[model samples]
Target: MNINSIKIATVTAGYVAGVWVLCSIAVVIAPDTLRYISGAMMHLDLSQWDWEMGMDTFVVGLLAWSFFSWVTVWCIVTLYQYSLRSFS
Candidate 1:
């Protein structure tokens, strides 16, 4: 729609990605790193030797994935909108 809108879109995407990264790191180091805070260290008993992470880690990973997904969607949307405005 406009430069301001594009900027907002990028900022939103960046924020989401940033949060996703933080959460992902949390998941990787979680339960232990997350201990004494957002609940107990409930991962070691679960994901220690697992090929894939346990359910908890998987869920956090999903959240991280969503950020990337949303960023892509928003970027596309913003570009489409901008194109329509400039071309029309």
Candidate 2:
């Protein structure tokens, strides 16, 4: 089945933004849980990461991630469509 590139990119951007927002909230509510989850799954050490959370940072992060996610998914979808066109 063929996929709509823009639709997929939009959905992925929303998903990424949602996840980042949740992570930001988790950072505020229960830092330890966030740290544990990141450590176990992503092998990231939250403590070592130097980041200050604030309104500006949150906005910047959300926009940055959303844009990045959109671009990444758009590229993937474009490549996939191109391959299908070449093969079929």
Number of the predicted model whose lDDT against the real structure is largest: 2
Top candidate on TM-score is 2
Candidate 2, residues 16-84, lDDT tens digits: the string is 999999989888887677677778797666766644779999999999999999999999999999999
Off by over 4 Å in 2: 39-51
Question: What's the true lDDT of residue 72 in model 2?
Answer: 95
Clashes in predicted model 2: 0
Model 1 Cα lDDT, one tens digit per residue, 1-88: 2445456655766676677567657756764444444434543343333334577766676666666666676778778787887889
Query: Which TM-score value belongs to model 1?
Result: 0.40
> Which residue runs does candidate 1 get wrong by more than 4 Å?
1-50
